[model samples]
Target: MSNTGKSLSDQAVQELVAKLKQAIATGTYQPGEWLKQIDVERSYNVNRFTVRSALSELHSNGFLQHVPYKGYRVTEHSLQERIAITEARELIECAAAARVIANMDSPGLQRLESLALEFRDALNAEDRPRMMKVNFAFHRCFNDYCRNPHLSRMVDELRERGVGNANRGWTKRSTQEASAQDHLDMVEALRDKNLVRLQALIHIHLNRWRQGYDSLSS
Candidate 1:
């Protein structure tokens, strides 16, 4: 543990950013709502400097928008931007899934199986939060073998937004079963080294996510 008044690990930074992004996505901090430095400092139990640093990092990454005198606001996405996100996810995730299928390892398979079970449990319990966690875990399970950290990181950043968006979608027990089954299919595909099926399944998974987003506005 390095001492520097407040030394944050990469994981810690990601968690903090995820929390803030979740807040923004869930309307806790509306699109136009001012993200006060003091409020985040007190709420998150950190100093204004940390808040500023985190916010700056997110802003630079296109998750937050800095207003001239009104503090920061969550960045809003248009339908076009949403579609672009979907397309980008399809390309990256499918490519990663292909790689995972091509270079399947025992550890990766074990991790994917574990994540699939977690997703099933979350789905059975109809727990959106847990399901969200499991869903990302499942994606990362395969993405870890991608051999391209930068691509994997991009998928992760996009997924933070994807999960937030998904939170607003209908996550009833019935919906949960379908989503969970999708995860299982993806895992099975990867485990069998079915590249074509894995790619298609990954594309469908992302399309479903985007469909949920589209349903909101319509």
Candidate 2:
């Protein structure tokens, strides 16, 4: 393949990886569900090489587990593992709150607020997939302000790892409402440049899903 051909192939693989990750995160692919390469090829209409590469990438990212003969399956975390991930998020996101606030300008703040409202609208419309997408966009915009690409990438990876388990809590209407409010309140904190309040809100928001998961488990 030429360099341009390889580039297109790489892009195709990355896109496939993202789509598969979203499917897993949204429960379209249940935990422990096997993902056969041939089935993926048929469903996605991609070549076998692309399917293999995409699956390999997801496996490296902790989104899938590979078995020699049986193929790949979505990874499932236990309660304890999920709690550890939540704590990691709190530590990183709360610590980064000040930086996030410092980097925000009026336009950036408006974008954040807009995304927050969009998330609420999705929630009100009971569009679970849209809600999830907007919620992710809201956070991604917020994290971009930290001005540390490596740190932002880590946050994204951690979020993807825990989203599957956290989604269980997101099913509750009350939990969803609280989360929507949390996003707006977070934007308010950014506008006011209240670092402490922002950190507190971040902690609370991160724990909301954990609380829901706990309630369900108990």
Candidate 3:
């Protein structure tokens, strides 16, 4: 085994994490394929320990699954699994959104509305990556209203995994458009101060995530 020069720096680990995430999400590394640490180190010119740490972080954040001695694979949760996870996450997220509606000041509401517009522009222009990012930001803004740090952390874990999972399934323009529409509706619901409508929209939005898997495969 050859030396990898030095161990990866903390900043470098974070950068690699983002790079590996995009590569896996974009299918540069296919779902369920083994990721060898030595290969990753060689490919990235990083230390083996760095590769392991990076993979471990991704696994914890739910982007990849560790297969014991078999190493890790980019996660590809089943439709049923997606449904279950979405159901669980929607409860926490919707509750947070309710709090957001109650507590949101003008500036926060403006942020959501801005994100919704960005989401629409991304979709109308067919910029999928930007669309996904804005989508994350929209919900994350609401989650901030929940206030309890512990609950916020719990929701964040699910959001990371669930959003990344949904990214895999979004391959159709119609599906993406529907997602963009949900963002628009969510912003309106916030602006209107309609708690019931907002919670319902949140449910439908979560359900739409599963729809992408069906839409793409069909």
lDDT of each: 0.71, 0.89, 0.75
User: lDDT tens string, model 1, 1-218?
Assistant: 56653456544566677789756543456444567889887888876656877898889988788988777877766656766777888888876776777777888788888888888886677676666666767777678788788888888777655444444343445556667787888878877888899888877666564444555435
Error of 1 at 194 (Å): 0.5
Per-residue lDDT tens digits of candidate 2, residues 1-218? 99999999999999999889877765678777899889999999999999999999999988999999888999998888988998998999999988998899998999999999999999989999888888888888899999999999889888878888888788889889999999999999999999999999998898787556556345
TM-score of 3: 0.75
Ranked by lDDT, the better of candidates 1 and 3 is 3
Q: Of the candidates shown, which would achieve the greatest lDDT relative to the real structure?
A: 2
Tell me how many clashing residue pairs each candidate has.
Answer: 0, 0, 0
| True-structure RMSD for candidate 2 | 2.3
Candidate 1: minimum summed lDDT over ten consecutive residues — where? 163-172
Location of the lowest summed lDDT over 10 successive residues in candidate 3: 1-10
Return the clash pairs for model 2, or none: none
| Residues forming the 10-long window of minimal summed lDDT in candidate 2 | 209-218
Better of 2 and 3 by TM-score: 2
What does the lDDT read for residue 138 in candidate 3?
78
Q: In candidate 3, what are the lDDT values of residues 104-173, reduced to their tens digit?
A: 8888878988998898898888787677667767777878876777887677666655555675546767
Query: Residue 127 in candidate 3 has what lDDT?
Result: 80
